[model samples]
Target chain A: MRMDLDKQLNGSVQKAFLLLEAFTLDKPEWGVSELARSLGANKSTIYRLLATLEKLGVLQQNRRSEKYRLGLKLFELGHRVSIHQAVVHCTHPVLEEVARAIAETVHLAILEGTHIRYLDKVESPQGLKISTEIGSLRPAHCTGLGKMLLACADSEQQQAVLDATPLFAQTANTIVSAAALRRELAEIRERSFALDREEYEIGLICVAVPIFNQQGDLVAGLSASGPANRFREEALPHYVSILKRGAEKIREGIGNFQL
Target chain B: MRMDLDKQLNGSVQKAFLLLEAFTLDKPEWGVSELARSLGANKSTIYRLLATLEKLGVLQQNRRSEKYRLGLKLFELGHRVSIHQAVVHCTHPVLEEVARAIAETVHLAILEGTHIRYLDKVESPQGLKISTEIGSLRPAHCTGLGKMLLACADSEQQQAVLDATPLFAQTANTIVSAAALRRELAEIRERSFALDREEYEIGLICVAVPIFNQQGDLVAGLSASGPANRFREEALPHYVSILKRGAEKIREGIGNFQL
Candidate 1:
């Protein structure tokens, strides 16, 4: 009976995934038929998949609205993935060293879709705390780590991402034009570092450098962020030097990792 | 051709989920055939499902091992689940209040399978530093919060958990017998608190009380812990009173939540 049922349900996997994909940042929760219509699948199929996903803790059904939202299990799995000992094993000690040397918040971030997702952060002991959560996503065009990653991407891939996204202004200092962003990326590549001068948020300045794998391909970026007052223009050279050295150490550590 | 392909692939959803279920903590990564054999599904069915899951980042294929492991996508979704928010929202103020009052580390934990998973913690202002990761899990029946949760379970459920596992002695004060454990649970129920006298680790003492929901069901536990030197028997009542008050606050907070 089980085998027959499995065979009968075999082709609905893509539709099930499509239904899940329909619940995103803007549409966090959805009713059954709304999900079915969004995914272009039948209501019965959507209901069955939603029920199964809920049972597996992938989706949670709200008792009041009969709407479904992403479940806690996804968060549990995301935490495990982001903190996979491989990522933390390589980054934690290096981030600590960077924090101690720079006296700033050191962050490690990797590309997730069109956004840069922070994987780890180490705060400076003396300064005012700059609290940033792991797994939080920031736009890839307006942040230091994002610019550092963009600097490493091939021109075609960079163009593709740019074409797909709106260069929305986040702050008075944000580089909103495609031409300006292109020039910044070129400068970042030439200097081997990227800077965010209140681009994402006013008063925050970030300096970042890319960490490459053994194959010399960019894997992630390491960044040091602080108030504009603290990370002043005169301090850029020193911050750049320290961030590059930290990135190099992390790259070396990544090279030694088996996974 | 695309429509034909979609139609052909439409029935494979459940088979894919079953393949994912094959991977667990003990068998975190698995080869294609091993997954197929374990799930009692065909190798072809498993491969197709795996390929789909891999594209969605639900299952990651390790390049070197040629085995599949749970992917980072799940972690990303899990991180967004707001469980940590629930923990932080429910416990942060209570933890701060208790930590300040007793000058000891206060923790909130929930039962996950056979383990007690620490969801939130606040460190004391002075004395030896007690370190614990937010998502770290430790064996139930060993820690104070674990014991508090276990004490609430029915005898058959308690026996089922205790009987199926290896009771590794964490310290000299650890309890291993069913009869002795039942007696401890009885006392804990009567007193409305639980204690760990260096049971999980030497030189550490912990006191815990249950936190219930509006329905009066145990939802989680709150605890205060410190070095054995500071948490003497004479100080037990003070610790117990503060812990119970913290738990009460959490229960009230949970009850008052509108969403």
Candidate 2:
């Protein structure tokens, strides 16, 4: 029989993907019924798909919570793609130079789903350390990288992402409303940089500039961050200049394909 | 008819995932027929899966090559996992301390599939620079973390992996024979550390010690590397001591958090 490809795909495989897609940063762990409800699929169908995915190491069931979260296999696959390498390769030397010049923690990040995932970071030499994890996902709208990315994205895509994700009040300084976020993004675009003024966490402020690829596309961001007290508004211009220079250096390095 | 749970998977999703999985680091790009043969699925089924995955940004087709490879979305997802953060959170201070003491590049890496994926690196202020990217992946059997992980893995798993993968000689010093690799792993196990003597790359010698979780399971490895000429065997004991101490510090920071 001649295979009708479209007809064959309506079978088991597609259902499994939908089940996997039902998971999000906020809802990293999900029960079987919760997944079924989110995917709009039947409970039994979700069960089978989850079981298969679990076996493949695409998902892991928390024995205590009976909830499924994304598994390490995704990370294993990501390592092969070298995405983190791309970012770190592009920004590490620049970050080190920036950190040495400014003596503060420098960060490189990119938008991933609804959060900003830190790709690289250089810590300062002082006793006060700014801690940020490389693979950690933090709410993008409230982060310097997130705002920079949102500022660069088209209006429709920006709106779609913001609409889909909830804006939690991480700190009193966070922008909660769509109107406020839109305004902030506009301001960020004009300045060619963004600042996290204790938006995501108290006492931590980050200043970031966008990184463009050879195509002049906004690919990632580079930032200099430290305690809010240390990076006060008076010190803003210095941080912004260092960060912009670092971003430019990274862009040049990216264009040149330097390791 | 009663629903057969296995049969209820949306076939399109399964086919799409299988198609995506078909592309590997060795063959990052593949044509339709190659994908079909690898998946043991039909051409038409493969085509639809590729199309859907491409549309969702999970796969990309190189217009010139007409071959498919894993897309930026995987990187996006990996960025969400923040594995780098886990490394940074656990090792940043330790690396800083080590860099201050040793004056060399210190790196942290974990086994990702068949390669060692670098997650964090700290550069020394006054030495010959050997910059390693955070997301770079290198063959596990020849590098410091790779040999450490191999030593940690069960004999059966190690043999199975070695048998399945072709051992490519990256440098003249690299161990290409299974027997030699087995012997190296035995020594690493006894010493509680691994050494890379210009094995994976020329002019580089690395000494690494495994970091464990609270449960005493090997979680990752910490390594201090420098130019082979400068980092002679005379300094091996010092490097090993520093690496072990750094690994212990990281293990303490991580405690028991598996995530």
Best DockQ goes to which candidate? 2
**lDDT, residue B222, candidate 2:** 83
Error of 1 at B100 (Å): 14
lDDT of all predictions: 0.75, 0.74
**Chain A TM-score for each of the predictions:** 0.71, 0.69
Question: Lowest lDDT 10-mer window, candidate 1 chain A?
Answer: A1-10
Docking class of 1: acceptable
Summarize candidate 2's per-residue lDDT along B1-259 as a digit string, tens digits: 1112245544344445555566666678888887777766677767767776665556777888898777656665554454544556557778879988888888878776678877767886764887565556688988988999879876775876588545778899988888888888899999988999899889988888888888888788888888888876777888888878887777888887553
How far does residue B164 in candidate 2 sit from its true spot (Å)? 10
Q: Candidate 2 residues A113-132, lDDT tens each?
A: 67777777888866688756
TM-score of 1: 0.66
Per-residue alpha-carbon lDDT of candidate 1 for residues B1-259, written as tens digits (9 for 90 to 100)? 0111123223355456545545655568888888777766677767777876777677788898898888766655555555554555556767878888988988888876677878777777786977665556788878998889888766765776578545667888888776777788889888889999899989888999998877787778888889988867888898888887888888788874322
List the RMSD of every prediction in angstroms: 8.0, 7.1
What is the fnat of candidate 2? 0.31
lDDT of 2: 0.74
Alpha-carbon shift of residue A184 in model 1 (angstroms): 2.5
